[model samples]
Target chain A: MSEDITLSLDDAQALSLDVLQHNGFSRAHAEAITRSVMAAQRDECHSHGLYRLIGCVHTALNGGIDTQTEPEIVDKAPSVVIADARQGCSLLAFEKGSALLVEKAKRTGIAALGITHCFHFSALWPEVEALSSQGVVAIAMTPTHAFVAPAGGQRPLLGTNPIAFSWPRPDGTPYTFDFATSEVARGEIELHRRAGKTIPDHWAMDANGEPTTDPTAALAGAMRTFGGYKGSALSTMIELLAGPLIGEVLGHETQAAGPESTAKPFHGELIIALSPHVFLGQDCDHHLQHAETLFEQILGQGARLPSQRRYEARQRSLCDGVTIPQALYEEIRRLGSR
Target chain B: MSEDITLSLDDAQALSLDVLQHNGFSRAHAEAITRSVMAAQRDECHSHGLYRLIGCVHTALNGGIDTQTEPEIVDKAPSVVIADARQGCSLLAFEKGSALLVEKAKRTGIAALGITHCFHFSALWPEVEALSSQGVVAIAMTPTHAFVAPAGGQRPLLGTNPIAFSWPRPDGTPYTFDFATSEVARGEIELHRRAGKTIPDHWAMDANGEPTTDPTAALAGAMRTFGGYKGSALSTMIELLAGPLIGEVLGHETQAAGPESTAKPFHGELIIALSPHVFLGQDCDHHLQHAETLFEQILGQGARLPSQRRYEARQRSLCDGVTIPQALYEEIRRLGSR
Candidate 1:
């Protein structure tokens, strides 16, 4: 069994920062990326926590990421902010443009931020949670390298295409959900492959368009979207909104451009923020509180609210710190040292 | 089997307008409602076609819709347009607000339209299609009466909320899709029940929360969201964005206010528009054409695109007209005479 070691969230972030900087990321990039990594660890989202450092270092080493480029902000219009990540990490781009997005949404009721030319590896929740914490409802989406097939299709022509949403609450954590449009996350299949386990039906297909339980064959073939055609439709919508609408490469284009050795996919992201104060004018507080009833009803019926688990984990991690696999910790420490 | 009759798209719209006017809708409301019904018929989407007139008449007779009230528009913010339907039908409110949404999006890159105090029965594709046709990407969503259970909950606490999206295609009809967030639409189960057939599992649960294949039991109990927790999260998002964010009623609240006889659900609708020209400046044309490659890839792989069927049906309906059951035609004519 792999041993585990404990670390404070702050320590986790510092370690991430050290690794990122050692991998040649600029200060701003390292700081922004560390924030998201720390957030994932704090919420015990293992896939995005310190475990992701290996992929980050690999991407940087393989030239999939530009560690020196700074994001360039463009105030496109009254309610649109565009960030040209200049082929750097998406974290800094989102960080720089989000303030303008919030300002515009506050002034105009809704605003959009488009981040282009970036390598994205983090979950979208942190971006939306940041916006929602500032009292605006937030939506974020991005297209990764094409790895999923469209509904009724044979080949992989769509990305996992993650989408996230955050709704502000009057108190406590905001309601949030971040999910890939694929039936399962691409990482889940990788995990299964590593364990030499069979995947469930409807998760993927073999290259010949045949259903397969073999994780290796599924990865070599195509992932399937959840809910069939409806999920496929959403994945396509993300491809349009975050891809062509922002003048960025689509999923297939990103896939075609990559070396395929590094797991990183360079693409664009779209974030939209809507302000309740701007939408409702004087009734903001009352309306925001009224939304609590719906949440209460969900909890009262034993149905879990999205992000409730994450928030609970966050509370614990804050009070008692977090644990990581000892071997993984050593691996990250070695990367930082390099 | 029922006998069928064919009618041109113009005749269909005229018939819808006549029936709506005879049923007490104002001229603007009648026109707007007729437009949606006509489009549905033209696209061979039978559910939203002339068959919807029955529900409209039923709701109007049951005092669920206020036909005399004109939609009141408010320029709520720089990129926000609010249309108060004053307890009237939603179609007119959306029609009134969409132009402003397009205008704002053209000016500011992104914009939102909120239609409140209305009873919505139409599919959201029409609203999004309208915006997409005006050269922008569009999204539309609304919460209906609570008929769906949250994931893990036995009670129906969320609406079978519908979301729609449209992406501009430059030449032909834009890519469009609108679907209920439920595993299967409520009407699908109702049709199964009326036909004395069993529904598929995963569509709903019995009152005890046990999965069931009985449509009647499901209807009397709770419908499930599509894609499990992911779809549930989306339905909840629609509830929040269209409900409290707009100072409108949530799904359960709408259900609590209504008499059980009418199928109409009074609520709010949200529409968001994003303009590519505003986002990409002078590169709009090149980027839009670039998106065609992605579409080609999907088509090339023999994977069907969203709304391809609708567009094909539209072509046929425009050339060869559309068919409806003679029984339905007679029923609508009878309502018009009334």
Candidate 2:
């Protein structure tokens, strides 16, 4: 069913926060997580937004994620920090890590944070955009359970392994780009499966390394790399950075039926924060100014900043209300009524 | 064509270096560039190997690339360095930059170097492999002249923007992954053009944003991203980091009519050098040990390390020498004879 009702940005966030609190999240943590999820929806990334609430609640109930624990900074240096998420909700952990990096970068001109043992953090753009809004360039990547295959192989050997980067522009519009390295995200595949639709053949391969268009067969198999060998290599690189290099288990060891399984996904996150002034020096301000002029000159009025479209959609959602599908809304209300 | 040559690796390196020296490169620079180029060829990356020498030499002669200029460290801190290549050959600049990053990382646990004003540096894998061999994790990215278009756009507004990473294993094999964000490299299109063959339709788009298999049309139009939006977004992120973030002109501004043109491509490079022990601490050695073992286990004897194939090819070339196509060999001889 199509949308029958809508919720304003504030109302949606408040409702989400209340739901989390009712389900055992602290008020502060609930607010943080709810805000992040709502922002994703407001920005039109519905796949990672309110749609994930049920899964998140299930995870929390099953002890796969913690809602109350806060991230603790265990080690700090001029340009690096080690954060123990302490099994906290990823929203809280990521926010803490981002803040730590921003502070360290203010002094060192660049900073990095190593985060571990955090739950799924939703989409990466919001956090990176937050950093970029403060005139900092941010790069982030994380590892998860295996869902994608290595190049030329049919076995699922890696997660989607998304990476994101955000940069501040002179016009106050941050350029943000975020995506999973897989040809398509696992969420997309799941959605297709739910919709009873066949996926594109190139998106995945069956157990025997044959391309398949049937969602059932694809799910039983493994997702292929985005661009064959290159994508496979990039996925491996992501694993190295967000896995063993960060003192976490690699993806191959983390693949199991669910997070409740004995196998820890051993998820890891790495964030790099950079200040343009650090390297630009005397040319710092001039560079930004010239960049704006050059960007405008080349793009003219037809071009928009990378994330500007999403941000515009978010603004609209805030000004007006966000529409919720009737089915999803009814489902949420039913749970709340119960 | 493959049977005529049988020189050892040393002889190949020496011969290449002598040719470079005779063509005006300084002795040290010649040896360094020659080794970098031949190493790729020996490793079986003919695209970036000696195949590139003719174009590089042409650029140097036409003043499009500097043959004798030295790259200088313009800015340096405990964990960062900004290098000005002064229009030097990228191989020379990249080597110096990698060395400096390694030196700084030894002290700071991690280091980054920003490079600007350099020519194409051949294959990125070689650079990362060099750093990884020294027990460092390396992330390198660079922007080239515009070739690929943004997703949903027809115009070529960004470079292929290759990103590379390398991680060391205790077994002396390094995992290296290097690739462009474009579905296929411009060089591949160039190869097709030279061979009078039709390009793959998925690889590029014509002016109207429709896919095409014509090499000439693809060259005049834009290359598609490796996998639709994901690759496009990644390329954009790279341009932000390696191009504008580093205070260089964006790809569109660097467009020109080849080596004879007075205009210079605004190539930019960023390298992140990391020490695994920094974050992993006491568990570092064990983690790496287990990682290597698990990697071998997963791949079994059938699979090889990411860089092993290339390294083995180089070893073979060293023992059996390299075979060059007669036409290409004659062209090299003609250039040298000039």
User: Each model's DockQ?
Assistant: 0.89, 0.41
Candidate 1 stretches greater than 4 Å from native: A256-264, B256-264
Residue pair clashes in candidate 2: none
Residue range B22-41, candidate 1, lDDT tens digits: 98988898998899988898
Error of 1 at A70 (Å): 1.3
Q: Which whole-number lDDT from 0 to 100 does residue A143 have in model 2?
A: 69
lDDT (Cα, tens digit) per residue for candidate 2, span A1-338: 36566788877776787677778888767877887889888987888777767766766776666678878875555577777777766677777677768776665566778788777658888888888888788988886677788775667877888888887887766768887888888878888989999899999988776899987888888888787777777777777777777787677666432555754434678788888877677787777775565345325525455576788888888788787787887665554423
Find the candidate with the highest lDDT and give its number.
1
Instruction: Kindly report which residue stretches of model 2 are placed more than 4 angstroms away from their true locations once superposed.
Output: A1-3, A255-266, A292-308, A333-338, B1-3, B207-209, B255-260, B297-305, B334-338
